[model samples]
Target: MKKLRMICLVSTFLLGLPMLHAQKKNTQVELEVQQPATGLDKSLKRKVAIARFSNETLYGKGIFYDRDHDPMAKQALDILSNKLASTGKFILLERSDLDKILDENDNSNSRFKGTGADYIIVGSITEFGRKNIGDANLISRTKTQIAEAAVSLRLIDVSTGQIIYSEEAKGEAELKSKSTLGVGASADFDISLSDKAISAAISKLVENVINNCMDRPWRAYFLTVDDGNLFVTGGKSQGLAIGQEFIVKEKGKVVKNPQTGLNMELPGKEAGRIKITFTGGDNPESEFSIVEFIQGEIDHSKLENYYIEEIKI
Candidate 1:
């Protein structure tokens, strides 16, 4: 009877152990989630433009057919752009706008010279292979899939016509599932496999590029308004620094894009200096900042009367 009682106690303890451990682990995870991101120091922004992916080489070997669109290259570019933008330290020009600049360059009749883009990103990809791996004990019958993607990007400085940033990355993902499971396995596994790995590599590249340009004076604007505060709604995470001062310039009349027939806005006039009191959180929509200093009294009248003139020498 004593042995049975002891056994019952031991069984109950063993069963409860997992619950205690699970609770502890969950608490730890919650604490970690609540922790703020480290490295909150000022991050500098770069004026970067990314070009579309160009296919450099194709990979396939054997009697099997290999003919399909490789979507990951462009997908990777888009993801990289978003990740870079997320850092809040970049003036990212849209890919379409960059293409427009390129188009203008290729045109002989166009009078619009390049805006002297600081850095241009060009990339190419090579798809290596696709294979499956799992429960492959049946060396011959096991359907194994392995895919490899290689990417290379160049950051060209328009001023010097030099490649300031160059990086290359390659990744392989494996899909191992029952043949009956169909194509969903490929899509699902790739997303899970690549999101973590590819994003990390590109994040490092972006950080490196920004670090290289940390000392350069990036573009910034300032303002003084009667509202007592100015919103910094859009900026690369590294674009604006805490305590950095800006000279507010009023934006002028609207302009039209001749090719796409789009309306573009320009800065009209210089107002006064405004200093950044604090930085923001991650997302642009979620960014919150305060205007700590304004030089002059600004109201709707000042805004209406503002007109920018070229700085006299």
Candidate 2:
């Protein structure tokens, strides 16, 4: 009877081994799926512009050949712009017309309008190359190659020209080839590997940038004011919450600096406070917020210049 029991126990253990392995494999897959998203938050949308990326790599220095013809910089810029746009968290402006705007400003055209971008994104490709990471064994010669890409990115607040966030990220892809007993297989340098590495780095960098930028308070302009009711530019799409209080302020005057010869907007004075009461629901794209005056008088004349600053606390 004891021998029979032992045999039964061994059989059960063998049967459960596959089940345990399957559970462990499933747990690993779940962990991979739980990886954080590499996109910006959808709650608040911001207007942004992506500048052409500068190539700062050694290859860009023309040591071996002229770098002007290299497409790395342009590729990086295009990829980043596409990725950011895909997130749907930003209103990307036309970068192609930027030179025209600059030329207009240089020509002393007073009517050169701004791009209205809240922030400008600039970046440079610092490192982009591939290297061999393979070794030769006695029985089998194995070779591995790694493609790497690195970039430095910065987000500048367009209104203040202040760098709100900056980050650098690096990514790599590996290819391995081995020959055992005269049978061999090898992998060559693939362009897709470099692209993938750069894309991975950009994804991580963008995630970091958005996480940092979103910590700031949201701001909007007052579209219309009717007695105690107020209509604001943003709504639920901009992360406006019910019962949120906003500080009302009058628009400031634009003054030209005598030293730098640049136009600047003076800080506005706090008028009073208002709280969001209702928000548009059907069309989120055209969403607006309705706020009731909590402790301020509506100035009909200032309606055009009035704006709301979110209370962070």
Candidate 3:
């Protein structure tokens, strides 16, 4: 019985070898992710240039301002500029630095003259104030006072001198003590008038700006494949770097919709992970990588499922 089984297994293996050899190998190894190129390189990361912010003030419901002027306008600008700089996505240039560049470049174009910036955020305080209202009629017989402030911001593309984004943010301050009753004795600190309060509001606005730009058309993604010392053809220019892991996927087939009778594209399947162990230093085009590990076989028949290729910078 064992001899017959062995002979049958050998015959089966011999027959399968020839059948597998008849399958043609796919030669299109490298995949392109974007179509039409979008005028921007999909493979390169997006860079930002954050310009100085303008300050403006507006009035709203609250106890009337004292003889001293509140510095909310300036406070807002400082807070927002710092917050934007911390995001690391932007190249934040201080007003002084920009002025110096303009001096060196000696250009008269107000847009860039001295600023090598991609984006510029110009903002102004529209209103700052507190108001009190008193009711004199029998129907009301009372008065109320409220404090308020508002700011308007706009982000412009310096290259095109066009506004890319604009938004208005407002904040209000409530007075706990009436000016008539507490004159000088009232709490010396007003939350709405404090730099910290203004900074917090501006921080929220800066965060909003960041979120808005996350899915922008120019956003880029990176993936690294380093198995058996696999190297990439692109580098910093291609926006790749060390310690990056890219998810591998196999392209899927096109299926037809039963009801519509239209062909629909199928989703790709995940293959494995590729980690970069090395990078091409001092040369962006000559960049290469060494593979750290591979999760699955290199030559899977499922390569048809590959899609959504990404690399890291």
Each prediction's TM-score against the native?
A: 0.44, 0.61, 0.41
For lDDT, candidate 1 versus 2, the one ahead is: 2
Q: List, residue by residue over 1-313, the lDDT tens digit for candidate 1.
A: 9999999999999999999999999999999876533322344455677755555654423356332344556566777788767867666666455555544544231222253345677766644444555553333223455656666777765533446678887766555544332423333345555544445445556666666555444443332343656554333354544555555556566667698554455555666665666666775334445554357544544543442121211
Candidates sorted on lDDT, descending: 2, 1, 3
List the global CA lDDT of all models: 0.54, 0.72, 0.50
lDDT per residue as tens, model 3, 11-128: 9999998667654222222222321121223334334444434444433324775312435545666667777767655545445464244235433225353343445666666656
Cand. 2 Cα-lDDT:
0.72
The top-ranked prediction according to TM-score is 2
Better candidate by TM-score, 2 or 3: 2
Once superposed on the true structure, which residue ranges of model 3 sit more than 4 Å away at CA? 1-50, 57-72, 86-91, 95-114, 131-147, 175-186, 189-197, 200-204, 217-240, 243-313
The deviation in Å at residue 37 for candidate 1 is 24
Residue 33, model 2, lDDT: 75
Positional deviation of 215 in candidate 1, in angstroms? 5.6
- Candidate 2 regions with alpha-carbon error over 4 angstroms: 1-42, 58-71, 78-95, 98-113, 223-231, 239-245, 250-269, 275-292, 298-306
